[model samples]
Target: MEFETKYITPDIKLALFEGKLFKTEVMFEHHMLVWFISGETKIIQADATHIFGAGDIFLIPRNQLATIINYPRDGKPHKTVAMHLTKERLKEFYTRHTAVGKLQPLQKVYRFSKHPLLESCLASLIPYFDLGDDLPPDLAAIKIEEAISILRSIDKAMDGLLADFEEPGKIDLTDFMERHYMFNMTLDRFGYLTGRSLATFRRDFKKTFNTTPQKWLTEKRLELAHYQIAEKKRKPTDVYFEVGFENLSHFSYAFKSHFGYPPNALFKDRD
Candidate 1:
């Protein structure tokens, strides 16, 4: 049995998942503050992977790519409370201060392990879960403001990470795509994160990769799938989702279409 539930307001919520495992690739639109209440999480980034167990607090900066694996541990479901620092709220908080922050290269996710203030701030929200989606706007805003204050008090960098409101600037398309192609998001979403409009993303993608994004993605995903299935001796089922195919059947269909044979054919001694 696998199910996930969220008791959420517009900016905050409790997430509960009960299953063997749950995986997702995300590029958040808002800077997210999260505290793990139970279970464990593996956050996979381009350069590093992080593990968060119960009582860990962390922040995922806006517009970063990550694949998160949630595991149910110690016979308990995976549970967490997540708060999003929205642009509107930040603007309100930092009103009359007009400053653009200079970014250091490639700022990664920030971790605050078991900080008492952050833990207290989030734990108060568990009871609010009974309100479910109807968590009140006024109360939610107050709680969010308190969290912002707590963050500012703890780290000077929180101001720059959360309050510097700027759209993503243009980045090197080739490198970005290579590292992030396995994430299954729409073309526009990919374009946004790489700081391009849809039209410009297509134009730049074509010039840099020398092929359409769709074709390139399909080929790259299939190639990775082929390497895993044939050389690494992994099953087709296990290889499929990791390479960005949504499900087994579609991966199988596309695999056969690309190689002129089914993926399972690469394996010997099939009973």
Candidate 2:
């Protein structure tokens, strides 16, 4: 599988990804708006999975973890254009548009229901992708504002989601860990997200979960992987990395150590 992703700007990315099915765990540092041009994606959040097809648009809030499953559709490569709104850019917009409204409570991910205005706005960005040249930052910024305007026309909540330019505060550790155990990220990242220093994070983690963070994460992921292979009939190779193990070898070893058998044995037992 060949995957090509070009960053048209620090904030805009054009991706052409194809080949076999693959999973990517993304912890978004910036709020992202995605326009799907071809193929499909299954966006798995902590609570729900969102399926998007060609011409679909969605917005993901910053500081959220999502696993994206990308695969070919009708033998065509998956293509998507994503616009990222950095905190600085969002702050600028918030200042420029004073009446955008008090921040509206919003979900972590918002899927725009079918709307012509939103579709048209996404379509307008295609020409820039086709230009084969760097997208001018000013023009890209204008497009971002245009997108926000279109979304606002659809739902006023867009104002709060886009205009409130604050980083996530210290989140609940239990909730965050329960939602993000599958993500392969550093312990430091986990600490930061939960708003703690590394040492405090470890100390607090032991108090809350009664286990080290690493051990808890491994057990949690392994438990889920066991269900997928034994009950759901998923392939071990497919399930291993998705469960947060860095490699098949490590996963296999750990599975055997924990379950007294390899993942393939679970599949065999299921068979």
Candidate 3:
């Protein structure tokens, strides 16, 4: 199956939030690294709650339930820069190294070690987040690659220190699907990609992502469609084809179900 990878420009996504902020439970479809550049927020994961503050970095693996509770003090909101990575791009860094595979979910809530090299690497990520709107696409990608390399190095070192670290199999599957959802594929094909049987993929996929493959694919398509409509100013027909949906009717139904309204609802003023 052929796959088309999408890159989100840094300027379009990089944001700082503050004040009393609360977000509903959401599932992240890509690997994310969040650094609390300042202030504090309460992060709730499936089994634990963490109080995050200055210099604290947190990793949220793909397709997991999470909530962020932000309480600002003195009218100042918490600040953060969250970096999102597509799985296919991240796979490029892990290809030749065994240790790369061992660093799947690095969810630490404390300060990183005082090693100068690691500190410098973490400092470099700030510029990636600081990319201006007019920055060239190639240059932005190069910056992202540099940041990923530094992060991978830190992850490798941390994984070596912690022997009990284990990759979450469900998260692995979710990341794979997010990266390849545009392909014309079947359950058997997905299983083959992951070196598993169709039956096993079905069983574990639901166990990990809390949904079936079809449901997940439908959601992924809708998300891409929404991004195109809202960000790229693309029409519904164009989004349907671009996101690999074969029929407008199917796309409309899924879009409505996912976003609680019809696609036209998003562009009624123009209509």
Candidate 4:
């Protein structure tokens, strides 16, 4: 069974998901704070895999795809709390504060070390989970501020992560697209990430790739899917969504159209 609780305010979201085993992949839209209340989990980013258990807390930055594996630990259901901080809120806070300009690039994920204040802040929210969607937005904002305050005291790095709210500067389009093609987001999102407007992104993308963004994405995703299914022995159903196809049927149709055979033929030929 999949049980998820989503509590949202204008700038912050408190969420919970309970599932025994599942693989989740998505491009994060906001800065995320995650706490595991029960279960063992694996977080995969590119070639890296991070494993954690109950009582673990970590942070992830926005604009990247991640694969999360939730599995039961010690005969208990997997449960976690996730908090998302919107860019608009971060920018508002950053503009009012001047001290954050002298910070460095922050790490993508920061595992919380032992901190009494952080623990206390998390503990205070335990009772609110019972209130569910009825929890007051102002109270939720206050709690989020409290958590950020605790983070600020621990390291100057927090300031950089939270306050560096400007849009991404112009980056190499080819490099950015290659690394981020798996994310199933709109052209505008891609444009923003590459520091271009929608028109400029399309113009630049065509110049660099000699193709439209949508076409390039479809081809790239299909190529990767083919490699996984043919070389890595992965099931099309398992990797279709990860590679950015909307559903299994659509993925199969496209796969057959591209390769002149269904994906299952790979395994059939191997045998």
Candidate 5:
């Protein structure tokens, strides 16, 4: 990572980086609140894509699977202030505060752009970023609490997302796997996220899909990559990581092994 961070704490950071465009896929364990200072980001989830630029403020909820692509805009670096809202902190806060709802809503992300209270809360932290360890321990907690309060007070939609503190329940195995196959997570991690043990996930997956998890994942990823290359005219370099393979070489080899030809061959045939 090529960036300079002015940290008030490990959880809150100023993401300052220049020159390079980068992409990453992740499943966040904590909700992330961000205020962009410059550049742009395109965040892709299972069903939607969002483009945000400087002065944009947004919250990505915990356990959301996303692919984030960051770019420098108009000669400036991709810079932002980000704070992680951890479950432990939220749990403590909600113990005293009255929660709005017990059921979770289906909203993908929350945008609180330029809201006065949120702006004030986030901007107040910039000065402390320079202080480093010299900053008091309780300050981070205070600011986080302030941010949470602002979120809950302003957005009617915030309650169900921020207040609910339950682990994921078991969903339709086939549907969950289909939607999330492109993410590269270990079997245990995948199982845990779907409210299953490693053994049960395997057992249920076999019953539902009639194939092992590894085999099913590889085939689904390759098929998606093939569609991108052959049907969508995308390059192998561009298609590899988005389709879940870690590297172009591995994706190419797998593409050849599975399809009886390399990905580039499909591109050439299409062209």
Candidate 6:
């Protein structure tokens, strides 16, 4: 199964996938906090069965083996907004963040909140669906940012529900990375912003996702590059630079290995 990343901002990502459910295995380099807007399915993970319905929220940590059965039929669609985040992303809001850090190996699933405040905030995100067109990048950015704010608010509220509260503010890692992924980002800097130690960040990150920070960052860049080549009609040369891949040969090799085809082949017309 293939999952595409869309509308990535500082702290969130809006992803969409329309595909038949078959027995499958999935993994993520970053944490996935999913709002299942529509669809009914049963997810089997770690020998446990989870029945999910519309309006239910599910959290899947970085690396896990799970199978989703799209009930009713395979042709039926399952739509969801998966907010891909990292512990480092949330730590930016406070000089002394502790909620996620305290709960090492946090709970992987939380039922939808009955709290009216959270319910209403989640409801507001539905309107952003109208702004999905690729045109109007400015308007799209504004709407997407608004949606991210709402998600952050919900995350705070949910964290409270779990009784793990932290500072109140938006953690805008998306803006930071847009400006700074080119520079060498150190664990010390990242930990200082999130109130974690470099050692703690590395340990928790590896425990939660089963991958190192460097590997995840590389995969994210490649994912962005793949999106540009296939969806944005971007040239390989332009995409390499745009995604901060300085070496074209490395980019091409990685692209071919990951996608099983040359970059140009992704844009070629098929019979």
The numbered model that scores best in TM-score is: 5
Instruction: Report the lDDT tens digits of candidate 6 across residue range 128-166.
Output: 544556335454344433433554465664333232333
Report the C-alpha lDDT of model 5 over 1-271, residue by residue, as the tens digit. Answer: 5777778877899888885777888788889999988999988777787998888899999888888889999898999999999999998998898887665845497888778788888888888887866888899999999999988888776878987778888878888888889887789878987889999999999999898999999999999998988888888898787778888899889999999998888755453
Model 2 weakest 10-residue run by lDDT: 98-107
lDDT of 1 by residue, 153-266 (tens): 888666777777788889999888888787777899989989899999999999998999999999898998899888788999877777788888988999899999999899
TM-score of each: 0.83, 0.89, 0.47, 0.78, 0.91, 0.41
Clashing pairs for model 1 are none
For model 3, the superposed segments whose C-alpha errors exceed 4 Å read: 1-12, 96-133, 157-271
lDDT of 5 at 58: 95
Candidate 2 local lDDT, 210-254, one digit each (tens): 998989999999999999987788999888877788789999999
Whole-model lDDT, model 6: 0.54
Candidate 1 deviant stretches above 4 angstroms: 1-8, 96-106, 131-137, 227-236, 259-271
Identify the candidate with maximal lDDT.
Answer: 5
Worst 10 residues of 6 by lDDT: 161-170
lDDT of all predictions: 0.84, 0.80, 0.59, 0.75, 0.86, 0.54
Model 1 Cα shift for residue 66 (angstroms): 2.5
lDDT winner between candidates 1 and 6: 1
User: What is the per-residue lDDT of model 4 for residues 24-120, given as tens digits with 9 covering 90 to 100?
Assistant: 6656777887777778877766545688787887878776557676787887777666767677766665566654545554636778843577767
The order of the candidates by lDDT, greatest first, is: 5, 1, 2, 4, 3, 6
Task: State the lDDT of candidate 3 residue by residue for 159-194, as single tens digits.
Answer: 332222233443367667666675445677667655
Clashes of each: 0, 0, 2, 0, 0, 1
Looking at candidate 4, the ten consecutive residues that score lowest on lDDT are 8-17
Residue 27's lDDT within candidate 3 is 52
Point out the higher-scoring one by TM-score: 2 or 6: 2
Candidate 6 displacement at residue 227 in angstroms? 42
